[model samples]
Target: MIHETERTAAAYAAVLTTCGDRASAKALARALVERQLAACVQMLPIDSIYTWDGKIEEAAEILLICKIKRADYEAVEKAIRALHAYATPEIVMLPIAQGFGPYLAWIDSVTR
Candidate 1:
């Protein structure tokens, strides 16, 4: 289990964001990995249902799943905001409860 105070550099985070289409999603993914903010970014097609501008809405979106060391989340969020086309992109981070030792180690190695 990861405690809140000790999560800065030692923990892992899975960041979530959505893009309107494939082109934008791919660009964001490349940027995150190239900057060493995330070890991997997986894109998946998803249908989103939400309320915006006081109205109900539904649309197709590309979900970006980014795996990164907890320490690098700030930089990652900044990078995403810079490149994202949406005015308010959904940038959320979730803690990784547990992962394979080798994979977790790889995440730490690739990110600062």
Candidate 2:
């Protein structure tokens, strides 16, 4: 059965961000996990096309999906800004409405 909660304190989140290169992505992922700001960070290579400086651009990037506690979103965002090398980085959070109970509990155990 799918696990769901109405705790107002909705427990978990998946934060997304993209890094220009593999090295930076790995570094950021490591930092978040090491600091316990994220329970886990999954990285994937992707091609992106976006507009910047009034022009269209395309580039290869590494996408980092960070699993964290909902309450720590601000702190996680702050750390990303501090460590990220982008003039304006992509930082987005998706609420995890329902998840396996054990996995959600694990996220809680690892993150503050």
Per-model TM values vs. the true structure: 0.89, 0.92
Tens-digit per-residue lDDT, 1-112, candidate 1: 8544444435888999999999999999999998899999999999999999999999999999999987788999999999999999999999886667777878878876
Clashes of each: 0, 0
Give candidate 2's whole-model lDDT: 0.90
Q: Against the correct fold, how does model 1 do in TM-score?
A: 0.89
User: Which 10-residue window of candidate 2 scores lowest in summed lDDT?
Assistant: 1-10
Per-residue lDDT value at 97 in model 1: 69
RMSD of candidate 2 to the true fold?
2.6
Clashing pairs in 1: none
lDDT of each: 0.90, 0.90
Any residue pairs clashing in model 2, and if so which? none
